[model samples]
Target: MEKNNRVIHHPILGDLKFRSLINFKFNEKVYSGFEGETIAAALLASGVRTLRCQEETGTPRGIYCNIGHCYECRVQVDGVLGVRACLTPIKEGMAVRSGEKLPAPFKKEGDA
Candidate 1:
């Protein structure tokens, strides 16, 4: 089964049916989304609203402000830490992960 997370028509951008569909992995699960869209946008479209949980209280958090101001949409990409999901454009085969539960952050895997 194929799931489409993109809008079929846009008033400004015209038809979105021809946009490039790319596959990306989020916390080990593969999802298809349009290339060049923000990671937060793609995730939201795929019904994933919780980007990460609060480190202190474990409260769920997703995109807020939808810009670069607030840090609520932070996510790890390609082993890099704290990349803003709303500002960063997702690419094909990209590996994205939520912040608090990630091993690289908790274990400091590369630190000696």
Candidate 2:
């Protein structure tokens, strides 16, 4: 079998392995994943392509940039929307859903 160029093998990082398996919900479906891995990475490993929707068009989007700059990989984690999945670490029992907008911050009348 041939290897894909986009695939990566870390020599020093070597055979990435994790023992602890945790359960989390993604888009209302229960998924088992390991701790210490980014939510995006875990989802990608699990064949989850689309993460959230675009703001304007409401079209589905996924991890265009694995790094945290693009914001395409946003997901709702534990009721918080627009949380960057690429930056967030996967936790056990996390309720993750996909959407576009972030939960609006509460603003006091006199504060602003």
Candidate 3:
């Protein structure tokens, strides 16, 4: 089925039609979501919001902006962490997870 970026006619959210349902694995748990839907949205629909947090504060974070500006919706997809879940699309067999810490900013040796 063709993918669309509308969430008004979703099957689960009756009358809200969303993109075609697709299967994906979140932290090894099988889940189904729509094709153009954000990873965070799918997780939230499935009752999952805690994706990851800042290493220093340990504060709970999820899709705060839903726009990709805030990094609160970061999650690991297929072993890659620090990815904005609100910006990534759901795909069949995609692997997603939480509790990932972003890598430290790279610094040039002896450049300090």
TM-score for every candidate vs. truth?
Answer: 0.79, 0.74, 0.73
Q: In candidate 1, what residue range of length 10 has the lowest lDDT sum? A: 100-109
Reference-based lDDT, each prediction: 0.83, 0.77, 0.77
Query: For model 3, what is the error of residue 107's alpha carbon versus the real structure, in angstroms, after optimal superposition?
Result: 12
1-112, model 2: which lDDT tens digit per residue?
Answer: 3111222457787665565877788988877667777888778877888887766567789998889998878888998777899999899989999875444346557865
Off-target runs (Cα >4 Å) in candidate 3 are 1-14, 103-112
lDDT value, residue 52 of candidate 2: 78
- Separately for all candidates shown, the number of backbone clashes (residues 3 or more apart, or on different chains) is 0, 0, 7
**Quality of model 2 by C-alpha lDDT:** 0.77
In candidate 1, which residue ranges exceed 4 Å CA deviation?
1-5, 11-14, 101-112
Q: Which candidate has the highest TM-score of all?
A: 1
lDDT of 1 by residue, 4-96 (tens): 566878999988655688889888898777867889988888888899887656788899999899888889999998899999988999999
Q: Give the Å shift of residue 95 in candidate 2.
A: 0.2
> In model 1, which residue pairs have backbone atoms overlapping below 3 Å?
none
Pairs that collide, model 3: 8-16, 8-17, 9-15, 9-16, 9-17, 10-16, 10-17
